[model samples]
Target chain A: MTIEIIIQAIISGLLMGFIYALIAAGLSLIFGLMGIVNFAHGEHLMLSMFSSFWLWTLLGLDPIISIPITMLILAISGILTHYLLIRYILKAKMIVQICATFGLSVFLRSLAQFLWTPDFRNVGNPLLEGRLEIAGIFIGQPQFYASLVCLLSFLLLYLFVNKSETGLALQATAQDRKAAETLGINSNKMFALGWALGLSCVSIAGTMMSNFFFIFPDVGVHFALFAFVAVALGGFGSIIGCLIAGIIIGLVESLGGLLIDPSYKLLYVFLIYLIVVIYRPQGLFGR
Target chain B: MNNNLQKAKLEPVWHTNKFIFALIFFLVTLFFFFPFINPSNFQLHLMIMIFMYAVMAQSWNVIAGFSGQISLGHVIFFGIGGYTSSFFYVEYGITPWIGIFIGILFSSLVAIAIGIPMLRLTGHYFAIATLLIGFSFQIIFQRWDLIGAASGLWIPLNWDNPWLTLQFHESKIPYYYIFLIFFLLSYFSIWIIYRSKIGFKLRAIRDDPQAASSLGIPVAKYKIIAFVISAIIMSPMGSLFAQYILVIEPERMFDIEISIIVLLIAVMGGVGNVWGPLIGTIILIPLSEYTRIFFGGTGGSVDLIIYGILIMLICIFRPSGLISFFPKKILERKKFL
Candidate 1:
């Protein structure tokens, strides 16, 4: 009711917004790169969370400290996915393309469940803990650090995408695969790089989330759905659009939950995508 | 060049000769007496499952395969069929037979509303939009308490007049026969469409809407028609499934997994053909059912893993689906073919 509570909500929403943007980054990148939705994108998130959790458990490393290792692990899996599954289906029917990834999603989720039961596991006592209150606005330390890391990663990714030569070639390939190939760019390598880069984004997001979110085989499912909405609202392949849309979603979720019913919070997030679909099928920022 | 290609596409269907008709009749007759032999209850259950899924997949084919717009959220109509029927039946004491019609009507209206806008978007956009809509429905139905909320709805056990209520406690045979009839009717409808101009026009849109529109086809009208047909096929089955199981949960009914399974059956068995869904269900259902029966007790998800792999392998190796494995000579029209 008061301005202080609304301010608190905005601050908290902003922090979670960064994480959501980070979570959506990889999905947007892959879709922009190859036009494949990566139905298993959520499973990749689940895997990265598990990887970070296990790293913490077995190696006695803090989730933050093991971010690089988890990113590496996820990047390799991404490379493997590109080589083993995606490349073959890239030119196939739409249904084939959809099913191949959908199957991979189902396969990976169950495999994770089979290997490490579906029971939720938490990273207890991560290096980040406690809450900070500044000017009557409360922020959890873990959420703050998570947002800070996500923002930093997004900036780094932006640089790599825009400033780097390989990134430009990647963009060229995404614009037109055959044209890029004619220009001596190996579309295959670009695709592989896209996968590695995409999964790495998921890994970073997952590692950050591991500090606060429960680690489970199905944990990524929720994030994956949210990422879909973010990608759609932001326009596929638009990084800035993703960030803005993610923030909007985060604010709407928090405000909707506060002003209305909590259980129906997700309804508002999805409604935004529906609105985007009807009014701007090209997405809010899509060309 | 285009004319020849069009001829080629149209010539493959319409093989309705006496022998083929007799063969189909013989096979249907054989299947009709199948339950009379008193097969094991498990086998009967499997057949029923196959018929149910076959019909669903074929229904989905009207939109996805023929029109070439994949709706990953096809389960929404199924959920609509189920929730509407069960709510009326469980609360108002309305018979499911009438409820089924209402469910069908609801789904058709929903299809018209959703299809007009969504069908305009092509390929991935359509798929993604439908998927989000489907998820939204799940969330809505899960929270709506009038239909039992998340706990789901169940028809009180009323075996007194099972026939009227669409619930038969006497045997699984009645369900099997009913489902078989549904399957045959659905197949017949699809078969009729397959030989009709609407089928050709749909496939034309599937290949290229621009080209179809250039030919003066009412692209918009046919697309919505396809969507409505698909919804109509899927809706009643949901009601029947609810009646058979005597339970209707929003989560189970609206799960994306159901959509995936239906797509798998249609795609792996050969889409763009009348027999594709039946072939897909016959192969997929039993494998999944058996795997779950044997290896799923510990919640291992072994069946799902296998199911996933099978779909991937089939999609990669046989993207045209298993029906293509048959001799092309036999599939084509003219002579015995």
Candidate 2:
């Protein structure tokens, strides 16, 4: 392949990877804190996308303007989800925990379909509409902004988790719930906060994606699948790992699509996932 | 722990019990006569769907429930079975009756290939791996033009010959009977495994793989065995599903939703048990159907919403399954009293 084509693919892939990392970081955080894989995580993303779509369509708000609103809405829903459904199943069997989230996913997807219908919706004349040409390469404004927002949020989340006291307390809770509780860090509240933060990340991703992609109940499925792979590949419960893995997946997917057939892009991602899972079950950055 | 283990081992075999015998007899008779009861075509179709799903769920339960290896990609085998059988019939003009066996073989081989590596991962990792595998299958099948690509393959219509092509024209009765037979075969195989030494080995591994391995259970081998058996039983359902629907698309055949639904049914009924899938299918199919009929318009997702709610509630309140609602004395026959 020409150097130009390779550069173009890498640029786009890295941008896509940032978005994947944002989504997967939330998933990894929740799993790290609660030890529960939220099967409905995709649904949460879908809901955010739908919310963005609605805000743009009904209220004539740009997706960029709707980002905060989407994040707030999804964060609350995430907290509510933990309280209403996840809390009850915390002590249940592994299968039960899985079923709870899986069921929630089905419920949310169906609810979206019921309320909004299955028709694909998109933001009309999004703020970032044109493509920017740089060095004989073109980048869609939406994609560039999405990647920028994703990187900024990733930085904020990293700072919040690593630098802030509350983030340390959250980490303590994730490390050892009982020990954290004994230290006067309410593990339950921490768990809820983790969910809120995690979902808010997804909300940002949805809002950014709404600028360029079609919004539908099932839109979350493919992205969610990629996020899952990213989380697993990066190592469960590791945010930095998720970011690195997400970028790797994005690169592989984009490059694979360009080099091989675009239709088999997912196949390439899955192949990499399988290889990582089989060879290094602990994941690239997992403890 | 030893006492409980002994008690588990000492659980009574109820095959000779009059109630058990009567129940088996009644079910067999019902299976035979249900098609002839003159139910509406819609009802028959529903029954076929229920039976097909139950078989699939039961197969899934063998690995997930009994062996404690949660596989979210069981639909991969099902899809393989469907595609294999369909390809055999379409390309070679072979009867599906024989093609079904080849499909089962193909599915078992694929299952083993997946299970050997995947079964090593515990719990959620395994689940995620399987889920990815299913998605990969979908993508591969969608792009593979040999299998008719995204549009999928339709079994040619043959009204004159019901026995050869496995097509019954407009009648749903034959499909119902075929699915029923497949369901019974799956149930009986599961029942045998549950009672056999293999079932105990699987349960042992499920409870504690380290302990089971220490006890010389050959843990990995047995898990593979369980996985293969599960895939073998599941393949026929896919084959029959292709015949019943007369249309097989990669997306529909290898849909992650199919895997989720089967897992839900098995878990909802009672995982790792012989009757769990059947009980689950009995409840879910009709529930989904009724919801679809009543809420035909205005965005028809009522059934899924309800199904989702029921799953969450069940997981929270009764994680063991709906079967747990029954008296332990009757279901378990522990100490016979």
Candidate 3:
């Protein structure tokens, strides 16, 4: 109805987009490295939120302060996932690869419900709890901060993957695992590193998200769905593509929810994804 | 090639000695007489479920297993099947028999529309697209008011005309027999398909679409055909299942769990094989149902956790499935037949 409302929605959507991109970055990185689309990526996000919530409650740590700890926790789980399950099914059929992660998702979702009792929980009083108005547009402090932090994390990940020697080795593995191995790079270590980096990226986003979003067992499902779309739409293995795609999805979701019925916002996003996949199988920015 | 085709037709794969005939007759007889044994209501319910899922899984198998296009969100058709027939039966006072045919027709058209675009994308792209489509349909059905909205449709009990309504009020016997007949017919049809050229061509498509296409098989057309066939196989069951339960909710109809369970059943029994879905359902469905009955399925997702673990383990350790455990000679059809 008003320009101010549209701007307000855009700002908030952009903020959420950064978080979505970070989540999609994890999925993209995993798929890029070993061609496995971690279906449990959503649960990893759920666990991270839970970890952040518990840290805030028990240790009185702000989500900002607890970001490192949560990242470490999720990174360790990512490694465990690789070493325990993924390493075995790397060369298995696509359905097996899918089912393994899908199974992990179901397991983690149920485990969370079993452990924390499926009740919606949230950070009681975050250190950052306010909104700021800029040029006739309002932005929540939590969302703005989360967006900034997510952007910062994304920059770091981009740097780590593009500039660092290990990062390039990880790239090398992704491009050609056998060639990378022949060149004396430990493809396995790079793979494990890929998972670690990937999950840690999401953990940061998840922690930031917990500051504002509801913390629940099934909270990750919608986010994970968005991440999957982002990963696919960005071309399965492109990190930068996921970032751009994530932002596009966020905008689409916000604008679509504004223009269309709010309930069908996600439907529009999926429609976009379907159109893209059907028309352009290589994705918008395929590697 | 010509001779092989003729031989296949002349000597169908299932022909065997009288001993096999007697065994088949005995098993059919036993299945028919199951309700007479005064079994627990739960047992009867379990059998009906097994039969129902066998149909669902095998239908899933036609596309996912044989065609090699893993559709993770396959329950969309099931939801479509259930909702369409239930809507007509409840609103127009029409018999479900006619409604079932309409459902099949409607779902086939839907599968065609979806499959043409969707089947063009292979492997993970196809799988995830179908998954999203499925979830999208669930969201739509949950909000759409015409088909009874989110709360779902409850078919009124037709005490006077149970047969016409496809609702059996007094006993589960009718549902069991009806589903058993369906299950057998479904299996028989699939068995025929598996032995026919279409079956071999589907298997070829499953193994490698590019190679199959190179060999002059119409890969895309065949994939769509398999996709529609799979949807057709799953369609009628929705009507029957809605009738059996007497309650059809969008949430219940299009649950991702149904899609996953169907996949788990197909994969665990052995993918790309006719016997696979039934075998998987036989072993896994009962275990799952019993777990729900024993462990309070009310409070938490204890069942999902189990299913997840079972699927993961099956994928990891026994990727070929449980059917592989049987001696090759019994289940394995002859090569070059």
Q: Assess each prediction's global lDDT (C-alpha) against the native.
A: 0.88, 0.90, 0.88
Query: What is the DockQ ranking, best to worst?
Result: 2, 3, 1
lDDT by residue (tens digit), candidate 3, A134-176? 8778889999999899999999999999999999999899999
Candidate 2 segments exceeding 4 Å error: B1-14, B334-337
What lDDT does candidate 1 reach at residue A188?
97
Which pairs of residues have clashing backbones in candidate 2? none
* lDDT of each residue in B1-337, candidate 2, tens digit only: 7886576567655524577778788988987998777899888888888888888888989998889988888899899999999999998889999999999999989988888888889999999889988888888898789889999998988877789899888778878878888778778778878877898899999999999999999999999999999989989888988998889999899988899889989999998778888889899989988888898877478988988999999998889999998888787653221
- State the lDDT of candidate 1 residue by residue for B228-313, as single tens digits: 99999899889989988888898898987788788878987888878878888889899888988887577648877887888888
Worst 10 residues of 2 chain B by lDDT: B328-337
Better of 1 and 3 by TM-score: 3
Q: Deviation in angstroms for A17 in model 3? A: 0.9
Residue A261 in model 3: shift from native, Å?
Answer: 1.2
- In candidate 2, what are the lDDT values of residues A1-287, reduced to their tens digit? 79999899999999999999999999999999989999999999999998988888889999999899999999999999999999998888898899899999999999999988999888888889999999988899999999999999999999999999999999999888899999999888998999999999999999999899998899999898999999999999999999999999999999999998887889899889889988999999999
lDDT of 3 at B213: 93
In candidate 1 the C-alpha lDDT for residue A117 amounts to 89
**Estimated TM-score for each candidate:** 0.96, 0.97, 0.97
Alpha carbon deviation, residue B151, candidate 3 (Å): 1.9
lDDT of 2 at A144: 98
Per-residue lDDT value at A226 in model 3 = 95
Instruction: Give residue B257's lDDT in candidate 3 (0 to 100).
Output: 81
